[model samples]
Target chain A: MTLTHEPSGSTAVTSPPVVRRRRALTPTRVLAGMVRVAVAVLIIGAALFPLAWMAIAGFKSKQEVVRTPFQFFPEVWRLENYRTILDDPAFVRTLAITGLGAVLFTLLSLTVNSFAAYAFARLDFHFKRALWVVVISTMFIPGMTILLTSFIVVTKLHMLDTLAVLILPGAAAAVHVFFIRQFYLNIPRSLEEAAMIDGCGKFEIFVKLFVPLSKPPFVVVGITSFLVFWNAYVWPVMTITSPDLYQVQQYLATFRSERSSELAMLMAGSTLAAAPVIVLFLIFQRQIIANIKMAGLK
Target chain B: MSTTVTSPPRSADGTPLRAHPPRDDRIAFLMLAPVLILLSIFVIVPTIYAIYLSFFNWSFYQDSEFVGLRNFTNALTDPEFRAAIRRGVLFVLMTLPIQLLLSFLIASFVTGVGKRLGTALKISVYIPTIISAVITSITFALIYEYSGGLLNAVVGLVGIEDQAWIGDVRLALPAIAVPAIWMGLGLMTLIMIAAMLDVPESFYEAAELEGANWWQRTLYITIPQMKNVLLYLLITGFVAAIQQYELPLVMTGGGPLDSTTLPNLFIFNHFRGDTYQGYSIAAALLLFLVLGAISALIFRVLSSEKLVD
Candidate 1:
C-alpha cells in the first residue's frame, strides 16, 4: 500500500522535454574538441617543421641561412644548389651504389625470408618448434651488439669495402622471417594440399600457389627491407672506407662531417637523400601501417 | 645431403613401395642452405671470434697476445669507460620517455580522429621515419648551429640570446637527442596509432554506456588494450637509445670533451684508433653482455606477463 504511488510517478516518465533542454552543445565537449584540434595541429606541425625548414634552407644562400631572424621562404631561390648536388661525381656514385644495394638487398631478403618462413609455417620436421623459437629469438638481439664481430667477419671474407658486406649481413632478419611466417600461417592449407595431390613438390607449391597469394606481405617486406637497408649508416660507415663505396646515408654522414660550414650544399644533399625514402613511404603507406600492426601482433 | 636418400619409410597409408625414389634432403638443405651458411659466417662465427678476441691484448697493426682477463679488468676499472656507460645511460634516459610519450599522445589523437585526417596524419608522421637518421642529424645540426641557424633565429625572436646548441658540451647530447626523438617519433607514433585503432570500437561503445568520457575511455580501454604495443615500443626504444651512434657521430663527433660519446662510438673509436684492437674487442664484448642482459630482462618481463601479443 505504501508503494502505490504510480499516480504521482507518472510525471517522472514525462521527462523527455527536460532532457531535450539539456541536449545543447556543452562547454566541456567544445573545449575537448578544440583541445583535440590544437594537439593535432601541433603534432603535425612539429613533425613537418624540420623537413620544411630543410627544404626551404636548401634554396637559401649560405649568408641568408645564418642571418638574424630566419626566413621561412627564401628571397631568391637557388636552383644551383640542386644542380650542384646532382652534378657532384661523388654524390652520383654514392646514389648509384645505394640504389643498387637497396634493390639487391630487397630481392635477396624477400626470397630468403619468404622461403624460410614457408618452411617454418608449413613443414613438419624434427625440432621444428625449437628452431622457430631460435630464429625469432634473434629479433631481440641489437645489431650494434654484433658490429665488431660483423666487421671482423667481413674483413676476413675480404668484403670490407664492397656493398656485399652491407647486403649480406642483413640477409636473414629473424623478424622478417617471423612476419612472413605469420602471414603464411593464415593461408588456407587446402591450396597446398591440392598442389600436393597434383604432384607439385613443396618448392613448386610454394612458388605456384603460396607466392601468388602473398603479394601483400611480399610488398610489405620489400618496402621495409628497402628502407632499412637504405637508411643504414653505422655498418656502412664502419665497413666502407672508400668514398665510392658509400651508401646514401654514409655519403650524407661524410658530407656533414667534412663540410660543416657549407649549409646550402648539405641541405641540398639531405633533400636528395630523403627523396627516395619519402617517395617509397608515400607509395606504400598502407602496407607499411599494416606491416607495423602485424609486427605488433606477433 | 644424401642421408635422407638412404633412409626409407612407409607411406602414410603404409603401402609397400613399387618404385621408391631417392629421398632428396638436397631440397630441404637447398631451401635453407643460403641463410644457414650466411648466418654462420656472418653472425654466429663472428660472435664466437669476438668472444675469443676479448680474452687477448691485440692490436690492429700487430699480432695479438693472450692477455687473459686484463682487458675486462681494465674496462671494469677505467674511469673513461665508466663515464661512457654513464653518458650512454643518460642519453637513453633523456630520449626514451619523451619519445614514447610524444609518440603515444600523437597516436592517440590521430586514431581518435577517424578516417582521412587520421590517414594523412599517420603518413606525415611516418615520413621522418623513412628519412635517414643521418639526414635528420644534419638537418638538426643546421638548425642548432650558432650562426644564422633556425633555432637561434627562433630563440632570438623570443628575446633570448643565441647559444651554440651542438657546440656546447652541456647542450650537445640533449641537442642530439632532439633530432633522434624527432626521427623516432614518427614510426613509433604510426605503430602505436595502428595498434590503438585495432582496439575494438565496441570497447569504447561499452565504456561510453558506462558514462566514460574521452579521458576515461583512453585510460581504461585504449591503454589497457594496447599494452603490448606500448611495451614493444618501450623495449625497442630503450635498446635503440643505447645503440645511438650516427647522430652524435655526424653532428657532434662525440665532441666538446666527449660529452656525447656513446658506447658504440667508443667501440668504433677503439677499433679505428691506434693499437687497441684487443681493448676494443673487450669493450665490445662488455657492451654485448650488457645489451644481452637488458634484452633478457625485457624477454622475461614480457613472457611473465604474456605481453608480447
Candidate 2:
C-alpha cells in the first residue's frame, strides 16, 4: 500500500523528468542547501560549545580558566586536577555509591515495570482499565508534591541516610511502566499464541518468548532508568546525609559548594561523573534515538 | 464477556476439547502485583501521609499538635512564600517562550537540511540535555564569576565595568535562567524538529506548486501541522520551568536576597532543616497542591482540545 501510493503519486505529478531534475540543481536550490548547512552548523555549535568548553576547562589550570575572554584552549594542561579528584576518598566513595544506586534501581525498576507493562498490554481482568488509568495518572503528580511524604515515610521506616532508601523509592516509577506498556502493546500477539500452543504457561511465555523478542524496549527502559537514577540529585541529597551514601550528583554538588574556588577540580569531577553516561550514549546511539521516537509516539 | 464451549473436531486421535478459562487475568494480576505494592509503599502511601502531615504542626523532636489549616494559612500569608510564587511565575514566563521559540527555530532549520547533517545537528543539540545539571551550573558559574571571569573579561574588552553575574541579587535569577535555558534548548529543539518532520511531505509539495515561498510553506504547512507538539512543549516546559531547582541550587543557592528561590528550593530547604520539621512538611504539602492544580489545569486545557492525540 505504501509503495503503490508513492510511485503512482510521483508519476501522476511529473512527466518533465529532465526539467525537474535540472531545477533541483538550480542556483535557488544551491542557495537553499547552503542556508541549511549554515543553520545546521549554528544549531550543532550551540549544543556542543558548552560541553566542549567544560571538558577543556577540566584540563586547564584555575588561572587559565578565567584568565581571559574565554580562550578556546589552555596554554598549559593540568592533569593533576583529575588525579587530585580521583585521589579523594570521598569522591571515589560517592562514585561507587552512585553506580550501585543506579544499577540496583535499574534492575528493580526493570523487573517490576516490565511485568506491569506486560499485564496492562496483554491481560483482560477486573478493573484493568481503571488500574491502568490510575497508574498513568501518577505521572502527572509532580515529584515535588510527594517529596515531604516520602521523607516522612523514609524516616519512619528508619531507612534514611542509607543507599537502600535511594534505590527503593525509585523502583516504582510510573512513567517507566507506562513507556514499557506502550511498547508491549505494539508487539504482535502471534508469538504469544504460538507459545501457548506449545504448552507454555503464561509466565513462561512471557519469559521465554516475549522477553526474548523485546530487547529494544528493554534497552530503552534500562538506559533511561539508569540515566534518571544516576542523575538524581534532589532526592539523594535530601534523604542521604552521610558522605558515604551520597550519589555522584549529590557528591558533585557538595564538591562545588565546599570548593567553590577550586574550578579545575570541580570541572574534573564533573567530567569524570558525566563520562559513563556519555560512553553508553555513544555505544547505543541508535537505540537511544529509537527509544526517544517510541516515547514521542505514545 | 461470555464463555462458550464447542466440541473439538475429531482427528485421528479424537481428542476432546479443553475448556480452560483465560489465563490473562491471573497472569496480569501477578505481573502487576510487585509494582503496585512498591508504588503503594513508596509513592501513594507517602502522598497520603504528606497530606495528613500538612494539617498539623508535627516536628521531628516534639509532640505532634494538630492545627488544622494553619500551615496553609501561614504559607498563603507569608511574604516570602508569596514572593517565591511570584518569582517562579516570572521565571516560567521568561524561560519557556524564549526557549521554545529558539528551539523551534533551530529544529526547523536543521530538518530543512538533509538527513545526515540533520542527525548530526540533532545529536549535538541533545548532548547538553544529557549532561548532568550540576555540570551546567558549574560551567555557567565560571562564566559568570565577577572577577577575571569570562563574562567580566568580555565586558572589560568592551570598556564596561565588570558586574557580578550571579552574586547580584537583581541579576542572580536571570543568570541562573541562562543555564537552564541553554540546557533545555537542545532537547526542545530535537522534539520540535521531529514534530515538524512528521508533517506530510505532500503538504509542502502542494504549497510549492501554489508558488508559496519558503516562509509561506513553513507558516502554513509546518507551523499549523506542529500545533499539537507545540502545545505539548509549552505545557511541559511551563511545568518544568516552574519546578526548576538544580541550577539555582548549585549556583546561587537562592542567595543574594532570595532572588532565585524557586518553590522546589523552598520546599527543599524546609524539608532539609531539622528545626522546622512539621512546618517544612506543611509547606511542601501546600506547594504540592498549588503545583498540582496548575498542572491539572494545563493538562485539562490541552486534553480538551485533544492536542496530545
Candidate 3:
C-alpha cells in the first residue's frame, strides 16, 4: 500500500488535493457538512436556551413569566424580583453560609489533601502503600450509600442543623488528593533534593518549591472543592433544617412548590445562586478543561 | 531529577537533618494527620457502619435492633425496591448512549472547527455543566412546566398542543432525563476531546494514505485509541446513573404515580419514613456492592490503559 511506502510523504502531499476535493464537494458532501453544522448548532442552542431563558425570566415580572406565548425578554427589566430575593433574611444568611463555608472548606480541604498527596507522591514512610490503599479505596464507594450513616454520625457529634455538618463532612476527598498526587509525582525529585542541600526543611521545600510549581493543579483542586461546598444540594438539605444555617443551594432547593409559584422570584433566586460558579467557569474555562484532561491522563 | 539526596550541614545530634529518612516518615505522618482523622470519622467509619447497619432495624430516634438477614430478604421481595432498580437501569440505558454519542459528536465537531468557533461552541455547552444542580433542575422544571413553559411554548410554534411534560406519567421519566442528557454533554465532550487528541496523528495519516475514508479511519483508529477513555466514561456514567438522585428528586419529586422514583429516591424516602429504615439501608448497601464490582472491573481497564502506554 502507498501507506507503507511513504506514510509521511503521502500525508504531506495529500493536503492540497484534499482541500481542493473538499472545495469541490458533491451535493451530498455539502449537504453532509451542512447537516453536521446544523446538528451542532441545534445541540448548542438547546443547551444554552434554558439557561438564557432562566436569566431573562429572572428580570421579568411574574405576570410576564406566566403569560401565554412566552415573552422572550422583559419589556421593562424589573429589579423587584431580585430585591424580593435579597430582602429575605433567609436568602442573605444562605448566601453568607455558602460563600463563607466554601472559602473555609476549600482552604481546609486543599491543605489536608495537598499534604496527603505530597506525602504519597514524594515521601517515604512506614505503611505508605497500605495507608494509600486505604485512602484510595474509598473512591470506589458511592457517597449515596453512606448518606444515612453519615447523618447518624453528624447527629451523634451534635452537629446536625449547624453549618459544621455541611462544612466538615466534605473537608477531605480521595479524588482531589489523587489528582493532586498525580501532579506531584511528575515533579522532579531533584528540586526537593536541591532544596535539601540549601538547608531547607521538608515543609519549606513543599511550600517554596512544590506549591509554587503546582499552582495550576492547586487552582483546579480549589475550584473543585469550592464547588463541592457551593453546589452541594442533597447532603445539605438532608442535614441542615434551620434556615439560618442553610447554604445557598439548600435555600434554592426550598423554592419548590409554594415559593416556586412566584416564577419570576424563583428564577431570580436561581440566577443569583448560579452566577458565581458560572462566572468562575467562564473565567477559567481553559484551566478547567486542561485540568480535567490531566485527570484523564492519570 | 537525580535520585540521590544531598547531605546538608550537620545538626546538634551529629546527623544530616535534611537527609534523615526517619524525619520523612514523621513529617509525612504529621502532614497526613488531619485528613486521615477526618476521613476515618466520616468516610471509613461511615462505610463500615453502613454495612453493619444494613443488617439491623435502624432509625435515628429508636435503638437499632439486630435483624440479621431479615432486611436483605425483605429487599428481595419488595416491589417498590424492584421498581426503583428497574427505573434506575432504564434511565441509564436510555441516557448513557444518547449522552455519549452527542458528546462525541460535539467533541469531534469542536476539534474540526476553527479555534475561535470551537471555543465558543465548547463554552456554550459547558455552561450548563458548571451550574448548581439546584439551578439546572429548577430551570428545567420551569421549562417543563405545563402552563407557559418553554417546552410548551416551543411545541406550540409547530402546531402541537402543549402537553404536561413532567406531569404525564408516561413522559415524566424521559422528561427528567432530558436536562440530565443536556447537563452531561459538556464534561463528556471535554473528556472525549482530550482522548481524541491523544491519538497519534500518524495513525490517521497512515490510514488515509491506505485509501481509508474518514469514517473508516475513525472506526479503525480513533475509536480504538479512545477505547479506555470511553470505558472510563461508561463506568463513571453508569455508576452515577445507578446513584441518580437530586435531578429527578427536584424536578418531578417522583410524582405522577411515582413513575420517576429512582433507587436513590426510594432509599431516601424509606430512610426518611418512620419505619423501613433498615430496608432502605439494605437497598443502599446492595446498590453499593453492585456499583463497586462494576467500578472494579472498569478500574482494571484504566490501569491496563496505562500499561499499554
Fnat of each candidate: 0.47, 0.51, 0.62
Clashes in model 2: which pairs?
Answer: none
Taken over the whole model, the C-alpha lDDT of each candidate is: 0.75, 0.74, 0.78
lDDT of 3 by residue, B241-293 (tens): 76777887788778778899989888887777746477788888888889988
DockQ for all models, in order?
Answer: 0.25, 0.36, 0.38
Off by over 4 Å in 1: A1-35, A126-130, A294-298, B1-24, B296-309
DockQ, structure candidate 3: 0.38
Q: Which ranges in model 3 have alpha carbons more than 4 Å from their true place?
A: A1-40, A294-298, B1-23, B304-309
For candidate 2, the lDDT comes to 0.74
Better of 1 and 2 by DockQ: 2
lDDT of 1 by residue, A1-298 (tens): 0000111222222111111123567899789778877877887888888988888888988778767666667899888788898999999999898999999999999999888878777764444555566666666555655667777678878998887888999888776776677677777788788878989988898899889977767877888789889889888878888888988888887777688677788898889888888888788776556455424242
- Candidate 1: lDDT of A45? 88
Query: Candidate 2, DockQ to 2 decimals?
Result: 0.36
Sort by DockQ, top down from the best: 3, 2, 1
Rank candidates by TM-score, best first.
Answer: 3, 2, 1
- TM-score of the B chain in each candidate versus the native B chain: 0.87, 0.87, 0.89
lDDT of 2 at B140: 83
Candidate 2, residues A3-97, lDDT tens digits: the string is 00111122211111121233557888789778767777777777777777677888988777766455757787779899998999988988887
lDDT at position B206, candidate 2:
82
Q: Could you tell me the TM-score of chain A in candidate 3?
A: 0.84
